[model samples]
Target: MDWTRQTRFSDPGRHHERLAALRGDVAAIGGVVRNLTVHYRASGIDFPPSRLAEIDTRWVSRMLDLDHERFGGAPLDTPRPIEQRLVGCCRDAALLTVAALRAHGVPARSRVGFAGYLVPNFHVDHVIAEYHDGSRWIGVDPGVDLSDVPLTPAGLHTAAQTWRAMRRGEIDPSTYGVGPDHEIGGPWLILDYLTRELAHRMGDELLLWDLFGEGIPYSRMEWSELPTELPDDLTHLDEIADLLIAADAGDDAAEQKLGARYAEDSRLHPGATVFCASPRGARYAVELASVNQEAD
Candidate 1:
């Protein structure tokens, strides 16, 4: 469990040397990448198929290739036009930031969770980089444009936290989703993301839309038909949430149990291939690279 080592998703491959431009600067990540959906929408333009295809650049090497192709080895902090930035989401941003940190010998990992700071009164499903700052892990939002005034750092409301809150009637399920005005958030979303949270913690940082396991849903359409009521694998999810919560709280035994469960249970871990429910309306199986635990 060497967080400083790059996982398959974060490995920079041939671009490993260029990550030195980042030099573990999390704040500078915003200069090199662009939020795919936010970019097109903010510009009041529709996404061409090519821009949409960038979302499939799951590995950091591919993303770096795209960036190098567009910007030609510019320092990651170099300012660029909005259209010239690399297309990605919060997950990709976190992946790149983690890769940069690890390249510079920092113990960094991506956390798949929900964040309340993206939109007012809504917890958007988001990803952020968590690095060990000597003694404790500190979570920070990656990809902040150096142009904007720095905002106060807010905490990431993890999927485990959201699930526990929903079960306790502490928050509205409808408020947790991708965007503010969508019929997307619910217990099903939490269940799906909890598995994501688990995979990320286990070093399998995957795409946000990639769904694995037997019962996981591909999209909102599949998620809709599933029951909205309690007790359909709610107990199982609750167990997972508790383990994750305990592990985060410095319970070593809980961490060990959680790791063993992930290695043994295919339901909680991504297999060789996962179903990619692309945002552009397509579902296809994408293969995953095997983890090499001994690499470091």
Candidate 2:
């Protein structure tokens, strides 16, 4: 139920057990319409997709039957933001899929970003569910409604679709057709690790580590960089690290310039860093806090 973990997916065994349960639960739901709402409430995870799916699939469906009619319907004729349409559709699908997985006892989360391939600059969105399947985190894409939308993971609108392919042991992340969005770096790397680990559990060859391409650039000298010997308590170390990176990158002004986008990610130790060699040594480091904080 509480999928959050400080260790993330460090333990593979627990991940697998939970994932299998979720798969079975989702499969039991049977149909698109029923799976979204009633099935979601029965499942039990508390998140956006779950809550949203309950409303749309159950309340909204009863009132409107959006799944049969609204989904895949023509875009609004009046001039409006495409972002709104993309987010609305993807959000609905994600909530439905997430609710199904969580109902079955699998810890899952929803992810959204540009489709990166076919849509190019446009956001061709999709949702992927992350669940722990005992040994590791697994990914599933319930968004692939094969009867109506023939999913080709190789095409540009592929993130959500390819996620399903990965679940079916049909594809790998790097080759999943669409390029990743700009922000799917470390935090996402951890997220994908969970997703890919689940894929591996299903006798799938896909591995998250293998998919790390010229991933988003990471600065090698963030302030939070800690000594390899982590502290037993692991307290203010994270905050300290954040400050260090902000300082090293130079001054409050510089840190401010980088903004929350980098601030949220810049998870590294002040003294050490991880560089992606294949991506030509893109470096990443932690942030800084105060001087008294322990480096570890």
Candidate 3:
């Protein structure tokens, strides 16, 4: 099925229908792989370790050379300002991954959650996939490649750490993972808003949000009223949080409300630093480094 153009969430039945489609598609595609190996003996068809590493991190252009070559001097799938275009770029990548895995007969589904990284950026988490390798589901991130560069200690940690932090209230549901308000418990208003806006932008294609699945946290609370105790050694995060809130409210008063805190905290902590201009996100990464460092 041409999932590239088809809406994956049109009907409630679509989800199950897609799974069936995937099963059938995998049976067909997996056959192709077997045929290629058995009939053709094309040893080159196999994914070399080096190539697999490349696939992991090429979703976004890393340097100027990459930007010029891969994305034509623009970020993928958008014709707007970078920040405003993030959701679309990310959603498209998610959809493409689903289609790619399905094409290969791998049962895959997209997931949204916090993906802590070593660098500071506008985005703190990632929305990737969990593919069923017949017996179990494995997290598959096609957001960016970490093959060339060593995985920073912060990035090296498993997704489970972020998961545990979310469940334990160490991380805020909103602004941690998928969307501004999505938590580990369930979807929140922010996701609803972003999804709706995206659907509208894409001419009504909400299926992208649920090609495999859309993860909403189990619960949520007002950011204005978080617990007194902060996550790990981020005692000062509260001050930054206040700044983020202020930044979101209006930038007229503060030149560097959200981005300012992010940049400062990032410099203060010594971890991996990728070239991302999102100040709020960079600061959050620094906060994570502080926690890991303290624990060490």
Worst lDDT run of 10 residues, candidate 3, spans: 33-42
* All candidates: TM-score: 0.86, 0.28, 0.30
* Window of ten residues with lowest summed lDDT in model 1: 145-154
Candidate 3 error regions (>4 Å): 1-87, 118-123, 146-167, 172-296
Maximum-TM-score candidate? 1
Across 201-220, the per-residue lDDT of candidate 3 in tens digits comes to 22232222221112222112
Provide the overall lDDT of each model, using Cα atoms, as 2-decimal numbers.
0.72, 0.32, 0.32
**Which prediction has the highest lDDT against the true structure?**
1
For residues 1-296, could you state the per-residue lDDT of candidate 2 as single tens digits? 25432112122222233223333544342233233322222234333542332222111122122322434332212232222222123334444444445545556544433233344333333344445567644444454431112223322232333333334465434432223444333223323333332222222211122232123222222223423332244223333333423433336663453333233433321112222111212232212111111111
Report how far off residue 116 is in candidate 3 (Å): 0.6
Q: Is candidate 1 or candidate 2 better by TM-score?
A: 1
Error of 1 at 110 (Å): 1.1
